[model samples]
Target chain A: MAPSDVNQGSQDDDVLQEAANWLKAGKKVALATVVSSWGSSPRPPGSQLAVSEDSTFVGSVSGGCIEGAVVTEALEVMESGESKVLEYGVTDELAWEVGLACGGKVKVFVEAVQE
Target chain B: MKTSMLDQILRDQEAKTPVALATELATGDQALIYYDSATGSLANNPEIVAAARQAIQDDKNGTVKLDAGEIYFQTFNPPLRMLIVGAVHIAQPLSRMASVVGYDVTVVDPRQSFASPERFPGISLNHEWPDDGLRELDIDRRTAVVTLTHDPKLDDPALGVALRSDAFYIGSLGSRGTHAGRTERLKGEGFTEAEISRIKGPVGLNIGAISPAEIAVSILGEVTDCLHAKEKKAAA
Candidate 1:
């Protein structure tokens, strides 16, 4: 007999639903999903983050480490209407710039929501 | 991803159906993969479809290397469930612990007094007879059933229904002697030895659990083990 709120789908479902709602309201949306992870990555594969053109976002693909960079890339995806895969590891120079220094690696796929 | 595909994923989730979203990284094309059917851009690729099916079975998300390019499979499965038949002392802690681990739990008992909301607080409760309650729940492969009531009248009927369903775990809380008698009665009811053997009597893993809370821990541990074992076998 968990509470009603506890039964409300899952966190990932909520993120997708939010993206859909944003799209229906005429806001360009992009979705980023963690395709794979290794080492001590905080989030697992299938973790999602939804971003709108207004910089509004929902969910997370990492433990507050690479979200800002992902949002920046998501806006670009929304503009280009093309999907892209991004990889980050502690050993990468870009990872150091993005602060994903948790001794883990993650690959994320970012795609724009087609109308 | 197409808006229509996203809508379909939400709809399938609402219907509690398992699905895998397969995305080809190179081209950004996507497909929705069901157990026996496929749709969307990548549907025509048999290798991607096969890999999607494997991902769904393993209940894990991973990328598959294909001849054309790598495809990432994101599996969406309905929540797991645990149904406790007795609503007894053990059921109280077991339900809460199972909920913490993401099991949608429901406590069933014919006696309304034992299944009271005050006792269970925020949990789901069913006051119907055990057999009737289980039938209404429509136990599926992702469900676990545990009968905690020591009464033969209640536990036996529940066990009969659980054995016939696709529940991944079926356990009965009882002493060895009590379980022996229960098995004899089940045999008398025409249940085959193999079928009756499915019940993990004495329920949990043998951690020498003494208290109700400790016993709850043991049961949840066994349930988790069974679930992972199934996944490991599927991955193999």
Candidate 2:
């Protein structure tokens, strides 16, 4: 990882700034931030993902396993304009489905990119 | 309001100022808090400001709950700093390695010739006295000070200021006997034995390093260990 990647916030901030620009351009957008995490997750709590009305996306929440689901929910959030928190846990059965080999829990807070 | 808040935050980050963003998750309300100024439009809530400021001082990021709501206090601090008080052979690799690992490194020495831009390109070079240079830099918890110049005139003054400040790690390069002499000198300079003990003489972990580059690696390892240890303690 680059030195900038170590802090995660700085990297996420750049993504958020880009999202804000996209929002200003009249593109509907939603932001998903990992508010909390448990066990040996690859990404830290402040990791982020931004999704747009056109299905454009930036950043990552689960590295891979749950991004597709989060982006799906983010598109819905952009349409509904209601913010929600999402929880994903890697259980034996769920892991098999999501392709997550490790056991951990991550809670992501999703909200519309307001203003 | 949202545009300006984000703008101010980006500005602060560009200036390397310490700041925090407090968001009430329930309501989606947000505020940008500046640590040094303690000034923000964050709902005029003293509890939130206090909590956010504490997190800023600690330089750690997390969320906290209050009667008002669950506020996520995300802190933004300046990059970690490494002040090497000698522009010597060890510092060449040390500064490069430190910078690679995300530290804003500054090499200080009174010898302008040694502290030239040619010797250490792409790094901040300070040709002022060690003590004055450190004072100008304003050593903080995020900074680590290491004095590689064995000359008392150079290293002692740097050590003096570092011991008094909150700089997380302080190390001096010397042999065991030299460190003993330095201990006595520091005692004469009015530092207590406990304070003097803070100086990690024979600096770096005991990896039996001999070459200057190898020594730099050892020192970097020790500095990294110290930083992580402090983070662990704060988390606990």
Point to the candidate with the largest TM-score. 2
Model 2 chain B scores worst on lDDT over the 10 consecutive residues at: B34-43
Which predicted model would earn the best DockQ? 1
Candidate 2 residue lDDT tens string, B90-116: 999999988877788999998988887
How well does candidate 2 score on lDDT at residue B155?
96
Please write out the lDDT profile of model 1 over residues A1-115, one tens digit for every residue: 1101111123378889999899899999999998877767777788899999999999999898899999999999999999999987774665457746777788999999986
Off by over 4 Å in 2: A1-32, A42-44, A47-83, A93-102, A111-114, B1-4, B35-46, B207-214, B230-236
TM-score of each: 0.73, 0.77
Query: On a 0 to 100 scale, what is the lDDT of residue A68 in model 2?
Result: 87
TM-score of chain B of each: 0.83, 0.85
Worst window of 10 by summed lDDT in candidate 2 chain A:
A1-10
- Candidate 2 lDDT, A1-115, residue by residue in tens: 1111123323356666777778779888888887766665566666878888988898888868888889999999888877787888775683356534466677778888655
Interface RMSD of each: 6.5, 4.4
